[model samples]
Target chain A: MSRRTSRWSVAFVAAVLTSGVGVLLADPHLVLLSIPAVVFAVYPHLTRPPAATLEIERSIAEQDPAHGQEVEVTVTLRNAGDRTLSDVRVVDGVAPMLSVRSGSARHAAVLGPGTETTFSYTVIAKRGVHRFEPATAVLRDASGGVTLETTLAADTELACRSPIRTLPLGHTARYAGSTATTDSGSGIEFSRIRSYRPGDPPGRIDWNRYARSGELTTVSFREERSRTTVCCLDAREICYRSSGDDSVHAVSYERAAARELLDAASDAGEPVGVAIFGVDFTWLAPATGSHHVATAHRTLEDPETLPIVPPTEWDGTPDDAQARELRTRIGPPTTVLLLSPLLDEFPLETARTLRAEGHSVTVLSPDVTTAGSLGRGVARLRRENRIDALRRAGVPVVDWEPETPLETAIRRGERR
Target chain B: MTGPIAIARRLLVGVGAVALCLGLLVLFGPPVESAIRWPWDDELLLVAFFTAALLLASVIGPFVLIDDGSQNQNQNQNRNRNQNRGNASPGAPERVPSTPTPGRELERVLDSRWPASLPPVRRRRIRRRLRRAAIRSIVRTSNCSKETARERLERGVWTDDPVAAAFVRAGGGPDSDSSRLRSLVERIRFPRRARRTARAVLSRTEEGEHR
Candidate 1:
């Protein structure tokens, strides 16, 4: 669409006033003064609006970027029409969640027929899948009287996943698995020798004990049990709080942690489940398989399940129903790895509730709180109090600050 | 009739063009001899006069008299078009400042009310919030009841600093009219007093936690 700017209307008004006064005064010079104004007013109408046919292509240097890495985005605009475009202003529609760290996303240039211009910018990669919007090009004619605005589409996406360096160690569950337990059973590691009983396997009997005492005795070994872990991610809008510039929300960190926890559990051949508590409760029953892990990751990637945009309006109440649903799903012998920012009281309550339900709950809270404003200071103090309360209740809480590496935080958690 | 009008318009445009060229020549070209009188001097003057009238009308015709309705519609259309394209970055949260100092919130509140005397109600509200924080800190660290914490705060014995204690002490009122000058001094020292009080409470909280 094209529209006139009417910028030279002042020239026309000046011309008429001068001509009217000249006629009344009968002065030829006054009339002559209106000539330039007339020319200025008519010049714009003579030139036509720019015929702009632009094709834009966007390219990202690294589509799969590491967390917090700067990625370069280049946009190439080609004037595909036969007419020269005198003034073209292109504003690239960068993803809303991503911030441009360097360079310009908006460019203004003069493009002749069959010419192209490229502009590059750097954006700090955040965790999540970010898709770029179309570029908007505003083309103006030489007269500046008319403008034509058009949108050029280019599909580009940035998927940044934070790598997990350390696996969570020293967790136990029921059933036979990799890690050795204290229970005496038929395993490689010897525990103690007992009096031999009927129906005991000959291989299980301790041959050395039998040879030494000439008595029948049964041998027991330490049991190996597979761990059942549930990586529960808090996706409520309240968990979307973030502190400092260029930082992703706490929900994003929780999602990343959940992904890593799932991978670790799956690798260890453990039955792992994922619970996403947001606007709706999404649950994946505990199971062990590559497909289950892939499904969990895919669910985390979907915006509907865990959105990049923080919800603006919500019920603003505690998610008691969601917590009830989760508690019913997880029982004894299953460890619940709760990843949350602990911004409000609900998460603390939820952790305590789950712990009270006989489930082993370990909270990995990513600290997104800052200590500047009175409100923020109070928030930080309250969060510390919450963690302290949880610790006093015998629930181990890992206070994970975002600036530190996840592995280091896990090690610190293990030590405590 | 249409053909005759068309020919007249074309002839008028040609005369205007010639007169414009002559005007430019007179402004920027070599000086013409004022003594050089021409045979068609009156006719040349008539042509210049007619050209100026025609040019003036042409300049004013489309913009002043005939463009009112169309221009507004065009502007409305352009605005709508821009609005349609403005949804490219919807729901993007604003980036927070990287360097935010602790107590900046209190600083902001005080700065916004600078120069103007803070209202008594606003002062009470700020003091109320501070008192609540002090009480919570005291109750947690000292393992005392909330009532006892409140009582300690009211008695101005919660902190070692007298200024901080008075800042959040219950029943702390504005100075009497007799001490008008002294009250002015107190108003000037409000921000500093608030900061000191906050620091004292926070320090107590920290110390209690260590203990």
Candidate 2:
């Protein structure tokens, strides 16, 4: 529409005048000008009129989304223009990479001038910033004639980077290496002995000294240190993750779960390491550290490649070899937290390999069953039994049905 | 927007069109009936006169009044004055009287079967096209066209387009012997009528029409 802009403007004027003047002059020779005019006429394809002055209001169903919860994003497009529009297409740019599960997010509506069309499209929330670009609005004249494409500038962006659920650490270890006398919680290592306070636990009373001094005194012990634990993430197949609402964006949730897990482990003074597997032709092995956490955070922000690589023509198949390579690199005695949609075999072997290596394996398999419970019912049950078989082989498994919170999974783990 | 206005306009337009058609038949249609024997004397002169009258009426018939309980007496006059600018062509100068330099040119050549002399229009377009071809030959000399030719030694895009290469080789653009030999190669590849895109992008560093 650049140089053609000027030519088209001229063509429009020339076409009408030449045709009008030709009829008046009764001269068909003016039709020569019609040739180019006809070509220009073909360009302005018919589309809905621009929503120049449109009032757009958007809302989500709830404030919070459980692990794989699906939320509906109701976007009401009010055509404030004083003109009728045909073939209106609306795409709600949701956070992360969750696609519309059930409802038609893209719509073509016929609205009279001033009337509004309310479109409801369901979006299952994933982790990260889902910035909504202004809706692309295209309006064409009735004859499939002049068409105008304008971006509705009044776009609303909603971001939801929810924290992954973490189980309460079996133990919290402390490290100070301080010799200074201080009154604190007791450990096997002696911290300090101070005058007993009323609320002091009877176990730390030091009975012999209490009788001798005739006054209450408590002996505090120094906090202990345990082995530094590393939690390596097996996140190669976030793409195939499907939710209870049949959303593929559940991959971001798995990422959020990974990040939240690192935070919980770090809270317990466990050194955490994260690795994002199955990215590209060369799978990246981001070393574990505070920096690794930040890198993982950045990777988690995008549901797709995390800008790890520009999108190529991906066949949408899992990288099994890369996953195996990652499985082989697990640090000894590290807690292997593997998350997947269970739609493939790469993740199953990863957890099995970790368990076989004698590392504690915790599997969070997000179920991506088919819709209507027809073909998915038997298949989903069989996969659950397969995970149970893994658990019997000495791996702790967490059944992650989409929308069921991580807390529910944790409680189930605890019962097991 | 309603049925009445739409219906009335339809009727008026329909009636006017019918009247115009009948007038056309009387005027433009051949008067074969006048040649045949009939109840009344079929005079050739009379038929010709009637036909002329019909022609006159056909011209005036449309300008005649349309009756939909409304007056279109001044509609044509109003349209003539207000003439919808949206429908009319604008008066703008042709930009890129040619396609953008050599890429488009190469794409065009590859897409379409090679042809003879390019369309003629503005002198600037032809010059621009040649310049673009020269630049392409000079730049992509190794990959695009033969680099041995003097013109190709100068620029490759020009040599890439068989027609432009020949023009430059036949002592057209440059006067070198190697350039002439390169021109020979161009003629062998392209027909006399078949034209290649001119990739004239040398004088200007900007990306524009090239062969």
Best by DockQ: 1
TM-score, chain B, each candidate: 0.51, 0.24
lDDT of 1 at B23: 64
Provide all candidates' interface root-mean-square deviations. 8.1, 23.6
Lowest summed lDDT over 10 consecutive residues: which window, candidate 1 chain A?
Answer: A167-176
Local lDDT at A70 for model 2: 71
Instruction: Write candidate 1's Cα lDDT for B1-211 as tens digits.
Output: 3565456556757977898887666556645423323334465565675577667667666765566557656544443343223222232222311223323445565434464456556666667767767877887788777799889988877789998898888755565564877777666676666667777887888899899
Count of clashing pairs, candidate 2: 52
TM-score of 2: 0.43
Clashing residue pairs, backbone N/CA/C < 3 A, model 1: A177-A226, A372-B102
Write model 2 residue lDDT over B3-103, tens digit each, in one string.
Answer: 55456556655765665565455446557323423233445544554455446545544433232213333322322222112222111111101111112
Can you write out model 2's per-residue Cα lDDT over A282-381, one digit (the tens) per residue?
2234343567566655655543543211233445445776666555655455556666655444566777876677766677766655433222332343
Q: Candidate 2: which stretches are off by over 4 Å? A: A1-61, A65-90, A94-134, A139-165, A168-188, A191-246, A249-253, A266-270, A279-294, A303-324, A327-332, A343-345, A356-358, A370-378, B1-211
Q: Scoring each candidate complex against the real one, what DockQ results?
A: 0.11, 0.01
RMSD of 2: 23.8
After TM-score superposition, what is the CA distance of residue A95 in candidate 2 from its true location, in Å?
Answer: 5.0
